[model samples]
Target: MKNNFSHFLASLIAVPVGLIFWVLSSNIFDIHLFLDVLVGIGGFGASYLPTQQIFHKKHLDKYKLTNSEYKYIKEQLNQADEQIKRLRSSYMNIRTIKDAKMIYEINRIIKTIISSVEEEPRKFYRGQQFFHSNLESAVNTIEKYLYLYKMPGKSKQERMQLHETRLSLLELKRTLQSNLSHMNASSYDDLDVERELIKRNADRSKKRQALLTNKLDKEKINLKKDQAKEYVYRGDKNGE
Candidate 1:
């Protein structure tokens, strides 16, 4: 919202700056009105485009997103936001605390996935199931469950359906968790690789240090032996 507002404010400033430029150019140079209008539009664009670029560049830098990635992620976010709203509506119809908590947990997981995807757009691809199908399915299932739950009287079959729906929701929650784990699997892999590298380097360093220590110890032993021989020779020569 703040970023959008900045663009809007920049546009407002640009309009006036453009008009001023147009007026100045026309009066000073006595240019044609068509040229003046063109200059005005150009001025507006020049002013607004830079501001937009600056804001967009900052946004891209913050998320490390390419323009295409940002646009795709934004589209996905919009769709997710609409689905989440529907999901929340189902929450309002929930009757039991247990069911409410379940819905809350699902919502929490979906939001966490969204937040992760927002920070790293590449995760959207990894979490396509949650972002694309599972989320919408969750909304539909919850709403259907709640609708059946609030019926005047549930038949044995309807109650059984409800039971299955509940189970399905639980399974869906687990699936969402799996999706999140999938999204972060690469990060975990990277961490594991780094840990292995560090361990190898540390072991190598320790070996090098140990070898150096052993060499120094051998040198010291040899030096001591040489010193003792020299002392014996000096004492024997002095006695002679």
Candidate 2:
């Protein structure tokens, strides 16, 4: 309301100043000579009110979009949840000690994903970084567990289960690696979007600051003009 009132006052003030210029120019020279200039000044002052209001509204909307990054993050979280379910089911069905160890190793990897998702991304450079770090640790642990449980001679069923577990671990590792790569690429894109938004906001602030500075300069010029007119009037009275 205060802003609207100020805009109204500016327009009220500009219209008469424009009319005074029109009158002065008409008296000294031709009425049409300064008519366009007077119209332009008055029109600009009137239009500025709506323009400034629109700009302020836009800035407010931009600041409200901080959660836009959550869309991509949520998809990654869902994938992690699915992986956890698969690992948990596999762990429950293990009969042999070797099979149990293999399932335990897989569970460790899934747990890493869960922990990564639970941690705040704002605390890290990117969400992928946390996942990747934990993934390396999980893989190392899995390799160590496999080496400890190696049997030189094994029965057919045990050998088959070992092969299946190895295959599953390899597949899981591939999936984790692919997901991490894609996530890193997407993080770069996200950073670009954020950077562009910051640049736009900075540009807007600069423009608003410039407009305010120009308005202050104009007021100062008007004050000097009024002082000059007073001095001229006083000198004329003394001469008379």
Candidate 3:
């Protein structure tokens, strides 16, 4: 964010600097109008290029991913995005709420899978079934199923084909669910470990707190006893 702000600031500064250059060239140096404009552009470029390069370098390095890996992941994500669009488009062909609910569930799974892969690019490897096959298959199956279901006066054979395609869509949904589970299994394991550690730390903290409270109570009792002894001695001296 800071880098982006700096880039914006640089751009804002460049525009004015460019104008200044143009004004100085035309008025003070008596340069030609075209040359003045060129000088202004050169000034803008000079002011903008350094910050632009710096911002890009920092932004790219922030991910700690190599350029090639980043590029490949970006390309794959773009393809996944297109597949998702096709899937959503297929949803419009759904006439029944029952099948619509299935598509919705499948959509949720696909989004979660993509989001997980996006957050941890390495998980993209785990979702090869989704990005490479299952998602595309689902889209194709949904389209084919709807196309058949919409046919006029479908004969028995056509109805059976529609039924089979519906089955294929259900199977695709299950496969997508499996793909999502596979992709997130490692993350779930990590979460389990983290939760265990947090629980252990919390238990230790509770024990320490209990011990400290006990110590404080003991000190309070001891202080009360000492005060009683002092009062008794003073009373005995006064009596003497």
Q: Write model 2 residue lDDT over 17-133, tens digit each, in one string.
A: 666656666676565755756665666566665655565454334433234444455555665565456445444444568657655655664565455444443322344643545
Q: Which candidate do you rate higher for TM-score, 1 or 3?
A: 3
- The Cα local distance difference test for each model comes to 0.86, 0.58, 0.82
User: Who is ahead in lDDT, 1 or 3?
Assistant: 1
Candidate 2 backbone collisions, by pair: none
Which runs of model 3 end up more than 4 angstroms from their true locations? 1-29, 46-50
> At residue 194, what lDDT does model 2 achieve?
100
lDDT of 3 by residue, 1-240 (tens): 123565887798789888998999999999899999999999999988886777666665775666677678778888888988887777667778888887788888888888887777778778887777787777777777876676689999988888887787788888888888888899899999999999999999999999999999999999999999999999999999
Instruction: State which candidate has the highest TM-score.
Output: 3
lDDT of 1 by residue, 1-240 (tens): 124755876787789989988998799978999999999899998898888787777867776678887787788889999998888777667788899889899899999998888667777888887877898898898898988898877799989989999999999999999999999999899999999999999999999999999999999999999999999999999999
lDDT of 1: 0.86
- Could you tell me how far off, in angstroms, the CA of residue 54 lies in candidate 2 after the best superposition? 39
lDDT of 1 at 237: 100
Q: Report residue 48 deviation for candidate 1 (angstroms).
A: 4.8
